[model samples]
Target: MDIQEKARPPAEVYDAQFVPALFAQWGQVVCAEASVREGDRILDVACGTGALTLAAADIAGPSGSVVGLDVNPEMLAVARRKPAQIEWLEGAAEALPFPDNSFDAVVSQFGFMFFEDKPKALAEMMRVLKPKGGLAVAVCDAVENSPGYGAFALLLDRLFGKEAGNAFRAPFSLGEAGQLTAICREAGLSHAEVVRRNGKVRFKSIDALVSTERACAWTLGGVLNDEQFERLLNESLSVLEPFTVDSGAVEFGMASLIIKARKV
Candidate 1:
């Protein structure tokens, strides 16, 4: 939990741990839904460590062009080291640097929840897409929908405080399909369609799960002191035991709301 000053950056932990456990599979899903094609221009907004962006590049191929953009330079730095002939840009979602109608498709995975101006960010995505370009976004479903996480959230509340607990639920903030659909419509992304899909999360052990969240800014955001994090970890052993498999790895069901739309 105490990512020491000399420790590997949190972004590295995310690419090494979080991506394989959660975001990696969804990368293909988002790209496919966004209709990424060879020789097409593609943009991945909030493309942390190039999960979805890498997927897009493969599909787009040597003939196609792909760009990954994110506000966090630390994350982008991690992305740049990956071996891919694609552009990696550092920028905000609310104000994309590309010109209008620039990309054939735009996609994001599990990043929309962090956008401060959701509507404006969605609009910016739409604005950059070529006419009739595809758009897709995937956000984790609510904490209530994920049993293990729900228990963890309650544990956080019981131990740390409501604020600490709420931080854990931030990724699930946009879980409601209706709310996301409304945001798309309001952003001038016409005919947005949302579908609920089941997903799964896995970690080597309960301790790995707890420690990963402790390091992830998207989740715990370093709110807990080292002692408090250790406390949470100890308590989670019992709270999350139901989801732990015989191999001692923690596995549980999750859901994501995949929003698909097109620019007209």
Candidate 2:
């Protein structure tokens, strides 16, 4: 299957109310360091649920502009309802709708892994950015680094073997710092740097977290089947039994890498 189809969830669960808030919290932190000047135009590619878009909007203020684009209509819908000031557009990262050198800054949060054509998306991001403009993209580190999700991943592998597991090259391709920097260079970006980030993966409950798996379609794509999926769902809940804390809340140590580059 193509990337888009593979990325589509079983249903449009992103329309849920809490989804936007969930993403916005971390999105703000991810784009926190990006410097924006007055009247600067920014583009948020793969703007899932408008997390980066909303953050960019906050940075751009009124005089400046922030354009959020994503291929998923469901995600765009969730993004549009937030404040209504951010310009929400439906587009693919591989083929941006803006002209060359159109944006002062381009940012993405946890999106580079899902791109079918990494080079194409990076090229598009570069083309839309003005000379010497900034680009920042963040991606989850490898499964080994993200130990917080160890139980969750173990359950998945138990249910589905290595073949259909989450080991698919797509998600793990840029998991390494060196690999991510190399990808930036290959995409025609310069002055690349990778920042290691430690974060938390919080969940209300194991079941709730597993249920939201559908919303994280891009990651679970092609990783599970009907029988295997159900088995994993049930097994994961059992695995999370010991980790239960107060109020059905659980937090795990998460690791990620922030790749910053310059369009020159």
Candidate 3:
């Protein structure tokens, strides 16, 4: 079956399933890189379900201010329910709602790759940062560098087609260090550097990994029919077994890049 455009995944499922397993840990990493301090004003663009935004708020503390913005109202709804007292706004990265020079630090984790206009979004991020403000943006490393996913992507191609394969591969669009650094420079950000870091991806089981992808529009959500989904799930058992530990959880090493810069 061919991949079809679909509504973004259900935010509740995203928040409940993938957030803890995949995105939560990176929150602190991005916040630390952005140098979020006790009283800094921070912004999290494309703050899906507020995983990274929550981390930023903790670092920023009660005295500090943090805002989480996303285009999806569903995601923002989930984010707004989080316990932290931070601002949750419905917005897009390409056009930030606040005034220019609005934040002491800006951090986005694993979110930039999906922007409709990457250049415009990056410029918008730069526009909102105060001079010398920290900028830390994270994206998945290239498919080639992420072996488990790389193999899974190819399997998708075999089972579905290039379109399905690409759907799975889409998240790593900003993987190259040089390319990311160049993009930052082109956006007029200063001292931009892209550092690749290793991370672990853990799913409670092989089924969990397959199911999570099925729930996410960025990956396989609308792409797989029930039969296709079952086929992929069944096929993935043996394919993903190498990464599965004795406890039946799937674990693999993934890489991510953090593009750090200053707005000076």
Candidate 4:
């Protein structure tokens, strides 16, 4: 399946299965860095399922405004159901529908790597922000730094060759701190700060993790045949064995970079 097709999973599956497992913690971290105030206006660009958007809304309080914008209508659909107060809009990062200098802060979590025109998108993000507005973005680190993901990539390469591996690696494309900061500078965002942090990724069991991967539209979903899927599950069990704790649950360290900047 193509990248677009892979990204079009049902909203419920994504929210129920993927959010708690991988996105919730990062959402909190990104929102905290945004430094939203009681009356601030915040925009979450590419806010998948409104994870970060919801967190921002709590900080923004009753008088403040928080808008969750996404290119996918399905994601917006799910986001709208969460908080009745926050506005959910269907839009792309490259061309924000809001007026210039409309928001006091902008934040994105694990979404920048997927933008087709990142420079244009960054420019648009800055254009919508008030002067001195903060911008916080979080992206996964390189696959090598993430052992579990590294193993998965190696397995995909062994099974389906380079294309499959590349697809798996797309999320980590902007892994380097220097590269991310440079991109922000090129897009006219000044004094960008990039920090690397470790987050814990956990799964109740190996089967649970494998199930999520198979169901995730952006991962190996629909790519593996029944037999290949079975083989992948069995093979991955061995690979993840080391990360499994005495309680039978699996946990691993995940490294990610948080890039903070201001529209000076």
**Model 1 clash pairs?**
none
Write down the TM-score of every candidate: 0.95, 0.83, 0.94, 0.91
Clashes (backbone N, CA, C under 3 Å), per candidate, total: 0, 0, 0, 0
Q: Which candidate is the best by TM-score?
A: 1
Better of 1 and 3 by TM-score: 1
Supply candidate 4's per-residue lDDT for 260. 82
Q: Can you give the lDDT of residue 92 in candidate 3?
A: 88
Pairs of residues clashing in candidate 2: none
Q: 64-161 in candidate 3: lDDT tens per residue?
A: 99999999898998888889998999888988998999999999988899888877888898899999899899999998887778889988999999
What tens digits encode model 4's per-residue C-alpha lDDT throughout 4-68? 32344666667765677778778768876766678889999999898788888888888899999
Q: Which stretches of candidate 3 lie over 4 Å from their true place?
A: 1-9
Among all windows of 10 consecutive residues in model 1, the one with the lowest summed lDDT is 1-10
Q: In candidate 3, how many Å is residue 198 off?
A: 1.5
| Candidate ranking (lDDT, best to worst) | 1, 3, 4, 2
| Candidate 2 lDDT tens digits, 133-202 | 8777878777676554666666656666655455532454577888877787788766777888776666
Which is the better candidate, 1 or 2, if ranked by TM-score?
A: 1
The count of residue-pair clashes in candidate 1 stands at 0
TM-score of 4: 0.91
Rank list by TM-score: 1, 3, 4, 2
**Local distance difference test, candidate 4:** 0.81
